[model samples]
Target: MQPGFDDPVFDSQGVFRSVMFATAYPGRIQTLESPSTAPTPLSRAAAALCLTLADIDTPLWLDEATASSEVIAYLHFHCGARILREPGVAVRFAVLSDLGAMPPLSFFHPGDDAYPDRSTTLVVEVQSLTEGPKRRWTGPGIRGTLEIGIAGMPESFWSDWDLNRELYPRGVDVVFTCDRSVLGLPRTIKVES
Candidate 1:
């Protein structure tokens, strides 16, 4: 809807709305439709995120293995965002093709006292998403709240998240993208074992 790009099948506005809803209702599953065929690891959920959040202002960092010219070109063509190499530098968005080898989530921006919203967001693509071992989640967006399970996450992630959560208003947020669906894990959410 901005201009010049070919029309997309899914309503861009609707996609954004669903993203907001998912963020507002953490742990909720949200499905999205992608107009064009995306490469493996880039699911409809990931595409929707790239389309909705990426813009001239956002800086994206792609995993080394997934950092192909085609991927970069497609992102630039569709989202008009800039690609960054370093994770520690200022970046609003990041995509992870191989979640297994991804750097520690703490490597990215975790914001600061004056600007808590400056933390980076990670879009992690996983093999599959399904209900797994049950885990307890509580915090903002959760209504006194819920218990759910997720598949394909490393145990170290939970350990790392414990540290991240302790940072409070200075931690980053994450989105898990699988197939055409996504799950939000806002920084405000606390994952308890």
Candidate 2:
């Protein structure tokens, strides 16, 4: 597999900015220009994110169903990331193919009191990104409230999120990808469903 960035140095930085902006302003949608390409089940934007954020030492977990040998080889060749077969271990990042079919919130590492920043970060693929539904977002980065709607996620997601939120600074951060757009849902953000 080849890198999607025409200029690795600048492109990675660009993607990083996109990621930062999305995470900084939770509930806001950001677009990725020249998103990297990936195998089916993984969006171009997601592939770009994996390339930009993950590296040789990053312990990453891919959805078992979507991680074909070729896909794994691509990531290894490009990012040199270590694949974590055991989800129980402390992994830095987890690539998910379908947000609607995600695992139990507790299945991932939420770090410990000593280092909450060590929690896993989920890179999820969703069906659509919209801000039309009657959902409100309020938290550290948000000013007053932000209304956003992410289509194709199971209602159980919010219920699961509620439990995840209870973990406070010890929960996994989430990044949602759909086509050429990406959105971040840091643990600090609260979803008022």
lDDT of 2 by residue, 1-193 (tens): 6456677678789889999999998978898865456767778888888878778777788887668787788778777778889776558889988655679778899989999988988898887778335578889788999888887777777787888999987998899998988989998888876
- Residue 148 in model 1: lDDT: 66
Worst 10 residues of 2 by lDDT: 33-42
Clashing pairs in 1: none
lDDT of every predicted structure (CA atoms) = 0.78, 0.82
What is the lDDT for 56 in model 1?
86
Point out where model 1 deviates above 4 Å. 1-10
Which predicted model would earn the best lDDT?
2
TM-score of each: 0.88, 0.92
lDDT (10s digit) by residue, model 1, range 1-193: 1222235534567677777777788988888655456644467678777877888888888888668776777778877878889986579888987767878878889989889788888898876656666678898888886776777677788888888888988888888887778888888888877
